[model samples]
Target: MRILIVGGGVLGTLHAWQAVERGHDVVQLESEPEARGASVRNFGLVWVGGRATGAELDTALRARVLWERIGERVPGLGFRANGSLTVVRTEAELAVAAEVAAGAEAADRGYKLLDVAETKKLNPALRGDFRSALWCERDAAVEPRVAQPALRAELARSGRYTWKPGREVRHLSATGVVDDRGERHDGDVVVFCTGAWTGGLVRELAGEPPVRKVRLQMAQTEPLGEELTTSVADGDSFRYYPAYRGPALETLEAGQPQSKVAQEHRMQLLLVQRLDGSLTIGDTHEYDQPFAFDVTEDPYEHLAEVAGALLGRPLPRIRRRWAGVYAQTTDTGRIVHRERVADNALLVTGPGGRGMTCSPAIAEDTAEELNL
Candidate 1:
């Protein structure tokens, strides 16, 4: 089978990975010389802890396994089983953590309520005043910036994978696609993993998928000169993830509402250290279309204050700040929006923030469904 993937982001790359691994020839096209979507602008967390129970959690766990295997094969991925710690400052937040930790599937989700001492032992960099932390040993991280290129390099070695960058897909057909160069590339199957690009041809074919765009802001800091042994999140993250929903969460929310700035930006503080020792921190969720053209400083300032407090010091100088958008389904229950747009083509997207965490498994399922 000759697979044609229209998009070079992580989702498309993972599809290409699956197709090529299944002995199928794959050709992936990207509009830019490199992908610069939500795929790269993320914490690269193979997050399993906070995934809602059932299919979502299963997918994340499967992806975690696949990520480890892929990371071993692609050293450039920088995959690490560093896990995560969601620090809680108040008893209300602690109650939510305790409930999750005591859930029936807690072990499966790697949920453990950690005391201050235990939390410090896992991530010594956290010297802040926190009552305890929710430890998730199944969580992990990767280098999102280089993951695609690294995967494509490995795919190239397969001798069955071809990557055509700087080629915008202008026309989609049942047989194949026509690029901006007016050249047609034929394939047995076509998959559009177009990320947040929902306009133009995408809307024409899918007629407005049950998905929408989500915008977020992220920043990278200069080298911290210290190892942040585990990824860290503030208790506010409970509001963003689905798994933390329950009576306890409701109580926490009622008792301890988000800060005004946090509420305004729909913010959550997630911090991960890059291979270079720099911290990648982000992010605030903005769902309305026509997102703000400019990134604001208030969110960044709040993130710095929260993260700095956790680290017990001021954050390193921020070197870069940017905003990115990703596709998400209106129905949060769905993992992604996969549909056959044409006889030979399928559109698989809307993994939302889970794109990085579940792409591998999503692609694996795509292969299974397509009988690749």
Candidate 2:
């Protein structure tokens, strides 16, 4: 089978990987020279701990295993099982952590409520005055900036995968697609994994999907000068992840309000050190459309303050700042908005923030569903 994969992001590349690994030829297309979307602009976290129970958590766990296997085969992936820590400063926040850590699913998510001593001992870089931390040993990280290209390189070695970038699909045909160059690429099946790009070809084919675009602000700082052993997040993160929702979380939310800037921007501090030693920190969520054309400063300021508080020192000078948008299903229960739009074509997207973490498993599922 020759599969036509539209989009060059992680999702699209992983789909290609699944097809090629199954002895099928794959052709992946992209509009830009590289993946210039949320796929590359993310924290590269294979986050499992924060996922809601049921299908989402199951997919994350499967993806984590797939990532480890793929990483061993493709060293360029830079996958690391360094884990994560959500630091809590107030008693209210500590209570929330304790509840979740003792939940029935704690073992599956690798949740452990760590004291101040344990927290600092696990991640010595955290010398701040935090009360305790919720440690998730199942969490991991990868190099987002290079992940797609690295995967593509491995797929190329398969001799059955072809990548077509700088080529936009202008028309879809029963057999395959016709690109802007007026060239026809034939295939038995066509899968669109077009990230946040929900307009143009995608809209023409599938109409308005049951997905919304999300915008976020993130930044990278100069080398931290020390190892940050684990990825870090603030207790404010508790409000965002569904895994921590309980009575304790409710009390914490009611008693401990976020700072004005943090609340207004819906911000959380998630810091991860890159292979270069630079810290990738973020982010704030913006739901309404007509999103800001430029990145705001307030969120960054809030992130730096929280990050400094955790490190017990000032944050390194920020070297880069940017904003990215991703598509998420408005129907939160669904992991992605996948559907067959045409006889030979299917659209799979809206993994949202899970794009980086679950693309591999998602792609594998796509293959099994289509019998590819």
Query: What TM-score goes with each of the models?
Result: 0.99, 0.99
- Position 317, candidate 1: lDDT: 93
Each candidate: what lDDT?
Answer: 0.94, 0.94
Clashes of each: 0, 0
Error (Å) of candidate 1 at residue 150 is: 0.6
| lDDT tens readout by residue for model 1, 160-254 | 99999999888987779999999999999999999988777888899989998999999999999999999999999999998899999999888
Q: Please identify model 2 stretches exceeding 4 Å from their true place.
A: none
Error (Å) of candidate 1 at residue 299 is: 0.6
Per-residue CA lDDT of candidate 2, range 30-81, in tens?
9999999999999999999999999999999999999999999988988999
Clashing pairs in 1: none
Q: After superposition, how far is residue 211 of candidate 1 from its true place, in Å?
A: 0.6
TM-score of 2: 0.99
What does the lDDT come to for candidate 1? Answer: 0.94
Question: Model 1 off-target regions past 4 Å?
Answer: none
Evaluate residue 294 in candidate 1 and report its C-alpha lDDT on the 0 to 100 scale.
95
